[model samples]
Target chain A: MLRSPRAIPYLLLLPSIVVIAAVVLVPVLVSLWSSFTPYNLTRPATLFTFVGWRNYQRLFANADFWWAFGRTLVFVTVALNLELVFGLALALLVNRVTTGRKTIRTIMMFPMMFSPILVGFQFKYVFNDSVGILNNALFSLGLITRPIPWLVNGALANFSILAAEIWMSTSIFAILLLSGLLALPQDPIEAAKVDGCNPVQVFRHITLPFLMPFIYIAMTIRSLDVARAYDMVRIMTNGGPAGRTELLWTLIARVGYQNSQMGMANAMGYVSILTSIAFTFYFYRKLSLSRRYMGGAE
Target chain B: MAEVHLSKVVKRYGALEIVHGIDLDIAHNEFVVLVGPSGCGKSTTLRMIAGLEEISGGTISIGDRVVNSLPPRARNISMVFQNYALYPHMTVRENLGFGLKIARQSPAVIEQRVNEAADILGLSPLMDRLPANLSGGQRQRVAMGRAIVRNPDVFLFDEPLSNLDAKLRGQMRVEIKKLHQRVKTTVVYVTHDQVEAMTLADRIVIMRDGHIEQVGTPIDLFERPVNTFVAGFIGSPPMNQLEAMIGSRPAGPVAVLADGTELPLPPEFAGRVTADQAVIVGFRPENLYPAGHGIPAAGQTLDMDRTVSLSEPLGTETMLFLDFGGREVQAKMLNPRLVAPGERMPFKLDLGHLHVFDRASGKSLRA
Candidate 1:
C-alpha cells in the first residue's frame, strides 16, 4: 500500500520559505529589475520606465567608478594576504603552547566578537590627525617632531583602513587553522623525527601541506567577508579626504542610498557582485587542487 | 640493533603515578612483550622507552647511554601506534619519503629507499594512493613501512594489532613475527592479549596497577608465577580460584571447600601452612582433566563432585564450566567424545600443577 500523505512537513517548511523570500529573494529580484531602468527612489513612477543600457554606459565612462573599483581590489588583496600571514603565525604559536592553552584560545577570539563598526570607530579616534592617541603619545615621547596627517593623506588613509581590516579578521584564520593543527595525527610527526627530520623541515613538508585545505577554506570565507567590507571603511574614512580610499561599497552607498539614484547604484552593485564571485571561485579552485594534490581523489 | 634497559623507571602525572619504578633489561635483538589488563602500566612503559614520555625517576638506556634528556629524534626509535596514524593527506610514496626528504637526503637515495620499503611491504602498486584509499590492513602495512624505512635501533609497538579485526589481528601477528625474524630489531611490544604475548615474546613482562608484577619467558610465568596476579593473568580461559581452609591435619594437610569436601595440598606446600590462615587455591583450566584419565602422576590429587554449568566445544578441545563447592571453575578436555550441560562428570585436579596464595597479600605461598 502507498504511504499516507504528510502535509505537516510541507506546512512546517512553508513559514521559513515565506520569510526568506520576503527578506532575501525579494530585495535581490527588485534590485536586478531596477538595474535595467532609470528608477530613482525620489520619483517612484520611473520604476516602470526602462532605460536600456544608459546606467551601464554611465558606469563605463565614470572615472570615479573605475578608481573605486581599483582601490577595492587592492584593499581586499593586501588585507587578505596579510591576515593569512599573521593568522598562520598566531596559530603556530598557540599550537606550540603546553599550558593554559584553553585560556589562550578563548582570548584570541576576542577581536572577532567585536562588531566591525566598533573596530572602525576605535581605530579612527586612535589615528586622528591632531588629537589622536598615537600622535599624542609619539609627541610626548619625543619620537615624532610633527603631528602626522594620518587620515588626511591619500595613501596613508587607504593603508590605515587596510591595516584595520587585517587586524579585525586575522583571528578567524587563526582559529580555523588552529583546529586543523590540533586534528593533525601525531604519528606522522613522530615518524618524521625517527627519520631524522629537523623541526623546520617537518613543518615545511608535513605541517604546511596538511594545513593547506584549512588555509584555502579560510581564504574562501574571508574573501566573501572582505568583499562586503562596508561598516569599517565607512566609519574610518568614508572614501575620504579626496576620494583616495573610495572603495566600491562607499561609492555604491553614496550613489544608491545618499543620492537615491537607485538604478545606477543597482548597476554598480551587480558589477561588484561579480568581483566577489571571482574571488570565491579562485579560492574554491585552490582548495580542490590542494585536496587532489594530497591524493584525496584520483 | 641494541638492548634497552629501564632501571627503576617511573612516570607520574602530577600526584598520580601511572608507572611505578620498573627495572627491566631487554637483551640485544630480543622480542619483549609487555602484557597486562587495562589500567596497567604496559603502554606507559613502552612510551617511556621510546622517549615519547619523560621518565619521572630512574634511567632508560638504549644500548648503554641514558636517554632521559634525549628527544625522540635522538632516541633512534620508531613507534607503530594502535591506530596506524598514517598521514591522511599524503600518498604512500610521499609518506614513506617524507622523513628522508626532511633530512635533505639525496633525491636518488630517497627514491631507492622508498622503493625498497614499498617492495618489502608489498605496497608498490599502491604507492601513489592516499591512506583513505587503502584498506585497514594496507594502512597497517604502510605504518610498518614508515617505521622500517628509518632502520632505527629499536622498534616500539603500542598495541598495534588492537585496531584490526580478529582475523586481521591474527594475520598481522604472524606478519609481525616474520618481520622481526627478518629484520632482527630489538622490539618492545605492549598488548593486553595474552595470546599475542605468548606467541611472540622472547620474554613477557606482566604488569598491574603501575608496577610490573613479573617478567619472564612466556612459559616461565605460565609455569612458575610469582603472585596470584601473574597466575590469573597469564593463561587463556584464565586459572580458576576457590576459597578454602586447612583441614585433615593428621595424615596430610588438606583443604576443605565450602561444601565440606576434602582435597589434599601439594606435599611441597604442606610445610608453609597453618590451620587457621585463609588462602586462595589456584589451578589452570587445562590442568583439570576427566577423571577416567586418573590423577596426575606426581604430588597430591583431588576428585570433585561438580555440577556442569556450560559446555563450549572446539574442534580440538572442549571447555567445561562446572561449579565446585560455591564457586565456578573452568576445565578443558582434549577432543572429548561428547558432554552435555548439567551432567555430573567426575574430574581430577592435578594438585602438583596447582598454586596457593595468601589471601591477604595475593602473594604466592610457594615457588
Candidate 2:
C-alpha cells in the first residue's frame, strides 16, 4: 500500500534498484572489499579475512604490474591515434565516392561485424610464423628471404595485435566521421571557394574544423574500447613470447583466473580503470573545446 | 571594376539542361539582379557567373579575360550565400580576413582590408564573435564584410536577405544598396522577390523556365515589359491579364471582354492587331482604380461600376478585388477609403497605360 506520491515513485523504481544492487553494485562492492583482503578462489574462508593494504602494497611494488600498466598506456595511445589518422583518411576517401555510396559504406563496416574472438583467431593465423599468409605473400613477392616471426618477436607481436585492433575498430571511427561529413553544409565549402580558397585551403580551414567535434567523439569511444582489449590479445599472443606483448587486461585475467590471485587481480583492475578514466577525461575536454570553438555550448 | 559578359551560357546536369543558353552583359560598376520564381534558372545563372557552377556550353568573360575555366578564386569574384555561410568556428575578423590570408597577403594588408570592411559593415564590435553569437542581421553583415574585404572585381549575392525576417530584410536591403554604392564594383544579385529586384537593381534580368524573359531598368520593365510574363512578374499584385478578342470600334481597335464589355486599346496597337484575333489585355492595378482616387489619365478612360468583393487596405492605398471580364481582377484606390465587401464602387480603366499581347505567343503587341 503506497501512502504518498513520493513513495509510489520509489515503489515503481524499486525493481531496477534491486536488480542494480544484485548485479552491478553488489559485485563492484564485493570486488573492492576483497581487494583489501587476501581473497583467493582456492580458500573460501579467506574472502572474509581482512588483509588491509597488503594487496595494494604488493601491487605497487610488483615490477610486472608496473610494466603491464606502462605497456597498456602506450598501447591505448598509439592504437587510438593511428586509428584516428587512418579512419579520417578512409572517411575522406569514402565521402568522395559518388556512385554506389550505400554499398561501399556497408562493405566498409564488414570488419566491425566480425566478433572480437573471430578477429583474434583470424589475425593469429595470419601472423603465424611458419604458415602465415602474410609471410607467404612476402616470400612469394621476393620481399623477404625468410619468414618473419610475426607473433614471436616482442616488437612484431605487439605490432600484430595493434594491427588487428586497428583493423577491427577503425571502421567505427570512419562511420562516425562519415556521418559528420554527410551532415556538413555545402554552403560553407562553396563560400570558402568563392572567398578565394583553393581545395586544400577549403579542406584545411573549413572541412577539418567542422569534423573536429566528430573526431573527438570517435576518439573518446575508441579509447575506452581499446583500453579493455583482452579477448583478441588473449588469443593472439596470450601475453607473450616471455610476456613481451603482455597488456594489463591479459595479465589481470591470467593472475585472477589461472593463478587464483583474485585480490591482486582486482587491485590491478581498479588501477587499470584509472587509465580509461584519464583518457575519457582528456578526450571529453577536447570534445567540449572543439564544440565550443564551433559555436556550440561548452 | 570589370564588366562581366556571358555568351550563350548554359548549365546541364547529365541529360537534364536546367539553364539554357542565355546571354547577359553587365557594365562595370553596375548592379544587375537576376529575378524569377523558384526553379527559373536565375540562381544557376548567377552561380555560373560566380564560377561556382561550370557552364555546360558557351563562354563567360570577366573584363577582357574569358573566365569559363577559371575557379571562383581565380575569377576574382566574391559571393554572399543565402544562408550567410560564415565559418562557424571563425570570428568575424577572421572570416573577413580569410581570403586575404589565403591569398598570401601580408598581415598589415589583411588587417587593413579586414578593418576597412568591418568599418563599412558596422561590424567592428562583433569582430571577435563567432557567427553563432551574432544575430541574423549581424551575420548577414559579416557575410557581406567577407565579400567586401576581397576588393573583388565583381560581387555575387545569392538571395542574401532571404533568410532575414521582413523587418530585418528591409534594413539589409537598404544596407546592400548602400554597400553597392560605396564599393562601386560590378554586382550581380539573385532573388525571387521582385520588390528587391525593383529596389536594388540598376538593371534587372527577369528569367523564366531557363530563358531570359526581359532585361531592362526597373522602370523600363514596369513601363514596357516585352511579354505578358514580364508584365505580370515585375510588378507587385502583378499586372491583371484578362483574355479578350481584338474587336474594331468606329473610333479604333477595342478589346472585347468575356462579359461583353469593350475597353479601348492604346492607339499604338491600332495596326498591330486584326479584328476578332484572340488577345490578352493587361493593365496594372494602379491603371485600373477608383475614378477620382487615382492619377488622371492623359488619354481616354472607360468608367464602370462593380461591387467590391474584398479590400486590402495598405495604409496610403487600398486594393479592391472584384469581377471583371467574368474573372476576379485587382483595382487600386489611393488617398484613403474604407470600402467594405458588396459595396458598389465606380472605377476607371486607363487606356493610356493598357497592354495587349498575342494570346498564342504571349508576346507584347507593342512595336
Binned by DockQ into CAPRI classes (incorrect, acceptable, medium, high), candidate 2 is: medium
At residue B13, give the lDDT of candidate 2.
94
> How displaced is residue A200 in candidate 1, in Å?
3.7
Error of 2 at B273 (Å): 1.3
lDDT of 2: 0.92
Tens-place lDDT digits, model 2, residues B4-108: 999998899999999889999999999999999999999998898888888899999999999999999898999999989889888889989998999999999
> What residue pairs are clashing in model 2?
none
Clashes of 2: 0
lDDT of 1 by residue, A107-147 (tens): 99998999999999988998897878989999999999999
Going through the candidates in order, their DockQ values are: 0.41, 0.56
lDDT (Cα, 0-100) at A149 in candidate 1: 88
Q: Which stretches of candidate 1 lie over 4 Å from their true place?
A: A1-26, A38-54, A57-63, A94-107, A182-197, A258-260, A288-298, B246-253, B270-277, B292-301
For chain B alone, what TM-score does every candidate structure achieve against the true structure?
Answer: 0.94, 0.98
